[model samples]
Each structure stands twice: as C-alpha cells, then as structure tokens.
Target chain A: MSTGAAEAAWQPSELELSRRSVRRRASTRSVVIALISTVVFAGVIGLALVGSPGWAVVQQTFFNLEIGIESFPAILAGLWVNIQVLVVAAIGVAVFGTLLAVLRSLRGPVFFPLRALATGYTDLFRGMPLLIVLYLVGFGIPVLDIFPRLPAVVWGTIAIILTYSAYVAEVLRAGMEAVHPSQRMAARSLGLTHAQTLRIVVIPQGIRKVVPALMNDFVSMQKDVGLISVLGAVDAVRAAQIEVAQSFNFTPYVVAGLLFVAISWPMIRLTDWASARLAAREQSGGVV
Target chain B: MTVLEVRGVRKRFGDHDVLQGVDLELDAHEVVVLIGASGSGKSTLLRTINLLERVDDGQILLGGDDITDPGVDADRVRARIGVVFQHFNLFPHLRIIDNVTLAARRVHGMPKDTAHARGLELLGSLGLGAKALDYPDRLSGGQQQRVAIVRAIMTDPELLLLDEITSALDPQLIGEVLDLVRQLKSTGSTILMATHEMSFAREVADRVVFMQGGRIVESGPPEQLFDAPVEPATAEFLARVRHH
Candidate 1:
C-alpha cells in the first residue's frame, strides 16, 4: 500500500475534488464565524459590566471567592436535602399522577364521582401557585393538629408532590389519549379485559410516548424542590440564606444558584437525548 | 351445530341506524363472507358481534350463550371468539412473538412456554419464524396482517371475525393474506368475514352475504350471489365493484 499506488488506485475525479474542497471551505468558514461571534458577544457583555459604576460593590457582594468557598460545605450539605426531596417526590408524583390520570379517563356512569374528584384535584392544584401550596401545607397542616407533627421538610416535600402530580397527571392523560382508538379496539377484540388492555397494552406505550415530557417535568421538579426552603427546611437555598444573613454578602446565594444549575444541566441534556432518540425512532419507523 | 347467532341486532350512531335489525348465523366449520359498499354496515355488524359496539337492540348468542345480555361479561364472551380488522392491529411495542402469544397467555392463562412454542409454530408455518423477535414496525404491512391473523387464531376460539382484513394490503400482498384465510377455511375453522375482495369471497365463502343501506339485501352460495343474484341491489353492487 504505497502512497502513490493507493492514489492511482483510487483517483478522485475533478468534480469530486472540487465538491470536497467546497464543503471543507464552507465548514471552516462557519466555524470561524461562530468563534468570532461568540468572542464579540462575551467581550461586550464583560466590558459593559466591568465598566459599570457599581461593579466594585456588585463583585464584592456577589462574586467574592472567599465567601463562595466558605459557603460551599453548608450549601453542598443542604443540597443533599434537595436531592432527597426530589427523588422521593418524583416517585410519589409518578404513582399519584398516573392514578389521577386513570381516574380522570374512566368511562361510564360508575366512575363519575372518581372522575370529578380527579378533575377537581388537577384543577385546584394546577391553578394555585406552587409557593401558595407550600405555604398552606407547610404552615396549615401542622396547625390543624389532626395528625402528629412531622418535620417541615416532610411538609415541603408533600407540597412539591401535590403541585407536580397535577401537572404530571395531565401529561399522562394526554399521552394515553394520544394512543389511537384502534389499539383499544384490537385489545378488546382479543378478549383482554379493560384492566388488562390498559395495563398490558395501552399504559406502557403511553408512558413511553410521554417520557420526554415527564423528564422535562422532573427537571422542573428538581428546581421546585428548592422552594421547600421557604418552610425553614435547610435545603441549599435555605443554607445560602443563612450564610447571607450571617455574612451580609450575597455570594453564597450565587454559589447555591450555580449548584442548582449544575444539578439540572445533566437532566436537561438527558431530556434532549431522549427527545432526539424518540424523533429518530419515529422517523425510522422503529418500535417505541 | 351453530357456532354464532345474531338475532335482530340493531345499532345506531346518533341518528343514523348503522345496523337495522340484522339477523345472521354461522354453523360450525362454515366460512361466511359479508360484502357491501363503504358505510354499508358490514364493519358495524362485525363489531357488534365482537362486543366492540353495543347493539341498541337484539341478542347475540355464541354457542347457545346469550352474550349480548346486559349481565353477560363482555370480556369472557370476547375470549370465545377471534377477530381481525381492516387495519393491521398488531401491538406496536411488542415483538411479533409476544403479540401472538399475548391473548393465549393472559386471557387463556396458558403457560408462557406453551404460548411461546405455539407462537413460534404459527410463525414458522407462515414463513415468519425468523421475524418473531422483530417488532411490528420492522415487518411489511402484509407480514403484520399475517401476524394479526396468527394472534387471533392462537386461542382457537369458536368463531373468527375478519373485518376487511386484506383491504389495507398492496395488490401484491393481498394474495398471501387471502391464501392464509383459505388455508384456515380448509382447517374447518368457523369464520364470518367482511371484505371488498370479491374474488376472495368467490373462492372461500360457503355463503356470500350482500348488504346495502345497513341491511342484508341478499345472501346465497357465491355462484348465486355473483353469477345469478336475484336482488337488483346485489347485482348493481357487484356490477359497480367489477367496474372498478
């Protein structure tokens, strides 16, 4: 496989060579353009901020490296709380939300009450702000004294589940409805019971179809878990609040915010990957 | 012995009477074909028998059991019959093997190994043994319809209902499906099918039923129905089908 022998064996035509060169030039030009645009945008924003009159105060309060470093341990530990709440609430939301969706989608007169209740639950929770639900459940439940006093963290986690399950249920219902009616007809014609048809045929496909939307909701849920901090639970944001109160600096808040972004970035990428895979599968006519 | 009996089956979708006082019967080992124009109630009649559509009036009996009675369990009644539809109704998420084995395993409570073996046997007989592991989307439309037929027959129900099974197929593919149906007819399986393929009706049907305006206008042996139809509507419909 000498170089000259290989070149002779596989000689490129003039048209092919020109086309290759053109493609190469276009790619290189686009890369250069992208780089220049990025540099200009970043430099302009950086210069404007540095040239501003309040830069010194803003930098000292928000970007102090020492304060950020000091806050890391507490914020990281508090982030563990957010993680626990997120994982538990995610599981709870999936189960409760699917149940609500099933109830809402039931047909005939026998399930009318259950359907109404599910509709009311979704409407009431989805209409109210997550923070208000947090306030009501976090403060209101313990005061009622009907149940034993649970930790504020537990109450906060409940609030997140309550609000998110409503949205997740709606997403699940939409996915289930999107399954063609022919599927149900086929299942029933095969002698599968209504329950069996839903379990064995419909729900599995429906859930797969909604995976991207569910992942999107889960990512938002990771952030909403931070809202639990308003209940005095020591989640990352609450820890940052404590640090800011003690030091009179906002750098800890910035650190906590960055940590939240760090946590959600992987999930966002995961959702993008899942959606792309789904699109590709559909285009190729592959099974879900 | 009669395998299925439909007595005065009536169905209405809003104001339109889709099946108006339809009465039909199928004897064991008989292959009956229903032919009609679009919206002529062929599908609605089959659907009513399968319990996919509730009849507004009349009783449907399967092997002397009044299946359309309000107290009757639809699921249990459906288990005793097999049905294929106009579209390929294979479950998309499942492999061909699983799709075939599902009703046998779940409804009949057949063992998994038994179902798998039976599914493989059916697929192998149909020249689809290698595709059992593949999902429905991987197969051609004709293959998918064949799998649907296999799935329907897995439980060996008392009767099989096919609703325009070969209509969705390409012209080249229709023969393979029709061949499978013909093979089933030879096996003494009782079938009541609705189809637009007049040639198939001529070949496989022991009795050819003609429907128009949601009513059975005429029915007889294929020779009488196709070559010597007594009813003007039947002759006109067959003439139109032949013109196309």
Candidate 2:
C-alpha cells in the first residue's frame, strides 16, 4: 500500500492521528524532562560527595590497592554471611508464607478465623519498623527473660523471618490466586487431592509466576540484614562500623554502601532477566 | 445392575433449591444422555455424582456402593467416577500427558511408569499422543476437551460423566470432540453425558432423558424420546432447541 493509504488505513481519522501524535509527543517530552532532571540531581550528589572529607579518606585508605587484597578474606566472609542470611530467610519465608496463605484461603467455618489470624500476624510484623522489631527481639526479649540466653544472631534471624514472612506471604498469595479457578477444578476432576495438586501443580506454577517478586523480596531482604548489624551482628555494615570507629573517619560507611550495592546490583539484574524470561515463557505457554 | 444411581438427590444453595429430589440411573456400558433446557439441573446432577458439589439431601450409588453414605470416603468414590467438564478444565500448568496421568498416580496409587504409559496410550487413542508433552494452552479447544476425557479415564473408572463437554467448543470443533466420545462408547465404558446435542443424543445414546425445572420430565430409548417425546414439555424443549 502507498504510505498515504497505509496511514489512513492504520489510523482512519485525522482526529485519532492527531491524538496519537499528541500522546507520543507528550511521552517523549516527559522522558526528556526526566533524563535532564536525573542528570542534574546526580551531578549535585557527585559534587557533594567530592566536597566531603569522607571521600578523601576513602581515597587515602584505598590508595594502596594491596590493602583491599589483604582485607579480601574479611570482605569475602562478610559477603558470604549476607548470602547465607538471605537464602535461609528466603527459604523460611517461602515455605511458611505459602502455608499461611493456603490456610488463609481455605473455605467453610474455619476460613474467617484462620484468615483473621494470618492477617493479624502479617500486619503486626509488617507494620512495625524493621529496626524496632530487631531491637525488640535482640534486646527486649532478653530483658523480658523470654529466651534470655538466645544470641543476637538468633534474634536477628527471627526478626528477619517474622518481618519478611508477612510480605512474602502476600506476594505468594497474589500469585496463587492469579492462577485460574478452572485449573484447580481440573485438578480436582482429575482426582488429585488438594495437597497433591498444590504440591505438584499449583505452587510450582505460582512460584514461577511470582519469580520476579520473590527476587525483589530477596534483594530487599539482603539489605534488611544489614539492619541486624545495629544489634551487634558482624555483617558487612557492622564490620564497616568497626573500621569507622578505628579510623575515626566515615569512609568505611561509603565502602560498606558500595559493598551493599555490589550485592544488590547483580540481584536486581537477575530480577530483570528472570522477569523477562518469565514474560517470554508466558508468551510461549511454558516455563523458561 | 445399574452402574450408577442418584435417588432423592436434592441440592440447595442457601434458600434456593437447585435440585428438588432428582432421580436418575445409568447401566453398565450404556450411554445415557441427559437433554435439558437451561436451569434444568443437568450439570448440577453430574457434579453431585462425583461430589465436586455436594448434594444437601441425596444418596448416590456407584456399582452398588452408596457413595453419599455418612462415613464413606468421598475421594475414593470420586476416583472411581470420571467427569469431563464443559469448559474442558485442563490443568494449564501440566502437560497434556501429566494432566491425564496425575489422577492415576495420585488417586489410584498407580506407578509413575504405568500411569505415564497408560495416559500416553489413552492420548494416542484420542489422537492427542503427539501433543502429550505440550501444555494445555498449546492445544485447541477440541484437543483439550479430548485430553480431558483421557484424564478422566486414567483411573480406569467404572462410569464416566460428561457435562456438556462440547458446549464450549467452536461449532466446527464440536464434532471432533463428539467423535472422540462416540469412539469411546465402543470401548464399553459406561457414560452419562449431559448435553443439548440432539443429533448425538438421537444417534449415539441408548437412552435419552429430557429434564425441565430440575426434574426428569420424560425418558425412553433415544428413538422413542426423539421421534415421539411423551410429554408436551419435552416436545416443546426439543422444538425450541432445534429451532435455535
């Protein structure tokens, strides 16, 4: 078709074409505005960083690259701890949260009470500040003589599980409910029991459907583990804090932030890759 | 002896009575087709047989065993009776073969290898063997419905209940799924299908039952029921459906 004929066929009216063009222009303009704003904001932040004494100290401390090599073992250990905390907490949250979600979704006389209880648990933990929860678990529990002998690491782990389970449960519940009711009915008609169907079919599909959300959860959880350092957990942040005290300088905190960025940056990229792969799989009607 | 029986089956959804003391029976290897207008309790009756939807007051028997007994294991009863839903209801997460084999493995305790082989054989018979590894979303409506049949039969059930299995298919696709059902009849599997397909009812069914307002209005051999329906309601229903 000729360009004029094709354009006419595609849009059909001058009004529609004008409206489309207006929207396209508006979107492009907004994108340009956002880019400019971001550049300005980033430049200001860079100037502030350059003017700070911490930057000079950071430069001086890392002036000998061999110092980094010597401290590699400590840094590696801290990184491993971060990973371990994330994986253990993630697994706990996924399993417990799924069970709670399933229990919340069950019907009949038991549904309301179970739902209310699950809701209460989720809301209570999720609504509280994570740092407060960590403090309460790590300090208040001992004062209250409730598991007084429990270590700070144990308290921190509990705090992480409690706070994140609520969030993860909601994500998983949304994923579970996204599956069509027809799928569940099909499972029932096929004579698979409810538990068997969930284990073999529903949860697997739900988990796949919520991969990106789960990855986001893990990424955030990794950052939140740093919060536990305030309770004397020897995480990367706590180690950096110790270094800052010894050097009487703030450079270690920046190094710690970089360390965190190093951990979360790959996870964010993984989330993007996983999200795209999931979208592709959904388009192809299979798991990628 | 009747392979299936539903007697005094009454179902209520809160205050509304869905099935008001309905009664029906199916004999071994005989295809009994239920013909009805909308709200005639056909689908409800079929669902109650498998206890997917429980009846408020009723007794359903399968092979002389009272399935609705107070202490009876409902799952065990359901496992012995196969049902094909109108929407096909293929589990989208599973492959076509897995959809079929799941019941055999879960309900019947059949070994994975045996269930897989039997499921594949059933799929092959239904001309869906090549698509066994493909997910349900990859198949056409008719192919999915056929795989539904294969899934239902995987437990080697004594009776099969089909709820308007072809109603959701395109007109062109309806024949293919029905043809699969027609092929199934020759295998000597007892079937009780709820449908509005007059030609299929007339040609394939041993008995035709006409229902209206949640009751069986008339029933007879397909020829007698279709050619000379006894009740005026039956005649009117047939005429109305045929007109549409």
Candidate 3:
C-alpha cells in the first residue's frame, strides 16, 4: 500500500512542472545573451569602419564589386596553375619525406652513411628560407644551363618539394617515435623481418597518427604555391598584380586572396573533423 | 625431446649483469614457470630466447640448431616460437581476425583465404567468433589477451613464451586468461612463462623456477617448490608473496 502511494505521488505535479519551466527559461536566457553579444560585436566593428574618413577611398580601391567581377575569369585561370603545383608537390613531398624519415631511422653501422646523408639534406633545406631556395633553383638553375629549356614553373615546383619535404620528414619522424616501443616488440616477436615490421605495422600507424599534421602542411602549401609567381610563372598573385598595374585598382588582389582562402577553408574543416573523430574513437571504452 | 636449451647465457646492461649465466631447458611437452621479483631478469631471459635481446655470451639451441650463431637467420628462428606479452599488445588498427592471421599470412606466406578461414575457426572455438571483425580497441582486456594467444598459436610454434601475460589484467579478468593457458597445457603445447600469480603458477606449472639477483636460486616440481623450497632465497620470496 505504501509503495503504491509513493508511485502515485511521483506523477508530474505543479512543483515539477514549474521546475521544468525554470530549466527551459535558463537555457533560453543564455541563447538570448549570446545572440545579443554577437550582434553588438558586429555592429560596433561595422559602424567604426563606415564612419572612418578614408572609408570611401578604401572601399573604391579594394572593394569595388565591378572590378572584382571583371577580374574573376583571369584570376580563376591563374588559380588553376596553383592547384596543379599543389597537387604535384603534395605527392612528391609525401614520397620523398617518407623515404628520408626511413633512411634516418635505419639501424647498425652499415646505415651510418645513409643516415648522415638524410640528416644533412633535411638540415640544409630546412635552414634556408623557402624564398631564397626558390630564387636560387628557379633563376640560378637556368643560368647554369642545366635543363636549360625547362619551364620556370617546373623549377619552382621542385624547389617547393625540396624545402617542404624536410619539414614533413621531421613531422613523420616524430610520429614514428611517438609509437610506444612495445609496438615494435610486438611486431618483431611475430617473426617479421625488421623491414617487414616497418612496412606492415609501424609505418601505417605512424602515417595515420600524423594525418592532421600532413593536412596542415598541405593547406599551407596551397598558399605557398602562390610563391612561384616570383619566378614569372603567371599564377594567381602574378595575374592579380598584372590587373592592378593596368587598372590602378587593388580589387584584383582581394579577389585572389579570397580564392586562396576558399580553397583552404574546407581543408581546415577536414582536419578538425578528423582530429575529433580520432579522439572520440580513442576515448570510447572497449566492449565487454 | 628437449625442444629448447639455454646454456651459460649472460647479458649485461652497462655494468649491471641482468642475466648472470642463467641456464634452463624445456622439453617437447612441458610447462616451465619462472617466478621472481621485479628486476630479477625473468623478462630478459625470455627476450634473449626470442632474440629480441642479444646475449653477451651464450648459446640457445632449438631442436639441435644453434640459433644464436652469428650467421643464423633470426627471423626464421623466431617463426618457430610464439610469444604473448604482459599488456596484450594487439595492433589497435587491425580487426581481431586480422591480428590473428597476420603472422600466418605475412611471415609464413599462407594464402589469404586459408589464413582467414583458420583465423575465424580459432576465434570461433575461443568464443570470440562474433568479435572477429571488431577492432582491437573494441575488445575488453581479457578478450584482447585471448586473441593474442590465438595469434601466437596460429602457426603451431614449437615453443611459446608468455611474459607476465596476466600481470596487467584486472583480478576479475585474470581468471579467463589463466583458463586459456590451462587449456593450452592440456593440448600438450610446450610453454615457458614468467608470472607473478603464485597460486596460478602452483596450479598450472609442471616445474617452478625461482630467480633472484639474476640467478635461478632453485627449480623443481611445483609440489617441492611451493610446499618445500630447497633454497633460502626461494623460501624468502615465497614467504613475502604469501604474506601479501
């Protein structure tokens, strides 16, 4: 009888209904506060910019919709060059960087020379500024009559691959080291040759662990592919420069910059999504 | 027949000798358990046999073959022995069935279909059939350890080395793993294990070897070692473990 009475009393009463409304109100209040803050932040920034003395001149020079639309076709064409260089250099760097990392990680006295060579390559390339390397390889190689007829764009791509591979190799090496020593032991004890262990077990895990880092490099590479315009490769930035010189308007530069961001934005989102997924997979407890 | 023999094995890390002239042997169908305190060279001895550690001075004979010879193929020798580590080191990226079939397929060059079928059969018999497609991280510690055992025995290795396999498991999960080891023993598999579970050792080991200060103090049948240890060091070790 007492249990039945307690069950009867557990039904939604006026007090419980009031408590539910209180919780709902608290959530609604937070959302309202957030919306107000966002609107105020945007309004203040917009008002200050519009009230500036040079607003009209700045807007006419850099934000002219008519000039932006006119330059879009040429800028889009130039962006194709950037995409090609990025795609080619991305593949080149992955292959070259993995080889360098493996060479550096080899054991025994027999590998000392190869290890030293790999280390020297990474140090030399990583120490020099990418711009300096690009200038030397892009301009100097032609003067030396080595591959004299090769296009400047090809030389620029090579320079990018050489510099970026060093950074990527270091990233890969760190990933390999981060794998616990026990993993190597587990693989080796399975009767796998050292090379087989690396190929089948260690390298795959290392590459997976460093995917976000690799994607970050690729995003940065997308912008640096523009650096090739210094070699007279006629990429987006160079095309934008040509437009600005002819029209005396900077709107073309803005269009080109927006294109770069448009390309990289999805990649950044992808990196975030991948990192979150990996974290969630790791944190989920095992099944019983 | 004597399947594995270790003679005058010595290993040193810097100036400290980890395994000081240790000698041991395993027959074709026997279980030898090593029990010792931490830093007593139990793990080092096991690693030396698998050639993960090169002994400073010793010879390990596997079926009359001198495996420690400089010219011997280490990979070929390792294929004949199985090992299970303390932490159930299953590859996190692989499915449970793939982990079991890896050595059979890659090292032994078994056909893919044959390897997978054998792997599934082993998992099914072990009550892990439903988990064959699940990733290692999706299995419990006990289940992962069992999968490791299944992987180790996939190729019918001549000797199995189990290094504190149950040490990292929870008390509740330890029984399941120990039960698998007992089952393997019943099938006449030769096993050499290092463990800290004294009662389990007493129950499962045909012979118990006690070590201290990088040396085997005493070894005999479990009845003699557990009930009446001959060496003072063995008695002291047993007393401390029993008190806990």
Candidate 2 lDDT score relative to the true structure: 0.83
- The full ranking of all candidates by lDDT, starting with the best, is 1, 3, 2
DockQ of 3: 0.80
Per-residue lDDT tens digits for candidate 1, residues A1-288, read 699898889978999999999999999999999999999999999999999999999999999999999999999999999999999999999899999999999998999999999999999999999999999999999999998989999999999999999999999999999899999989998889888888888898899999999999999999989999999999999999999999999999999999999999999999999999889977887555
Ranking by DockQ: 3, 1, 2
- Model 1's alpha-carbon lDDT is 0.94
Report the lDDT tens digits of candidate 2 across residue range B76-96.
Answer: 777788889899887777788
Rank the candidate models, highest TM-score first: 1, 3, 2
Candidate 2, superposed: residue stretches over 4 Å from native = A1-76, A108-117, A141-151, A276-288
Q: In DockQ, how does model 1 score against the reference complex?
A: 0.78
Query: Which residue pairs come into collision in candidate 1?
Result: none
Q: Which segments of candidate 3 are over 4 A away from where they belong?
A: A1-27, A280-288
- Per-residue lDDT tens digits for candidate 2, residues A1-288, read 599897777745798889999999999999999999999999999999879979777676654344444444565566567677777887888778888777766667747888889888888988999999999888887788756486677778888998898888888888888877777776776667777767776787787788899899988998888887878878777776676566665556666677788889999999999998778865877543
Query: What value of lDDT does candidate 3 attain over all alpha carbons?
Result: 0.93
Best by DockQ: 3
Reference-based lDDT, each prediction:
0.94, 0.83, 0.93
Fnat per model, in the order shown: 0.81, 0.51, 0.67
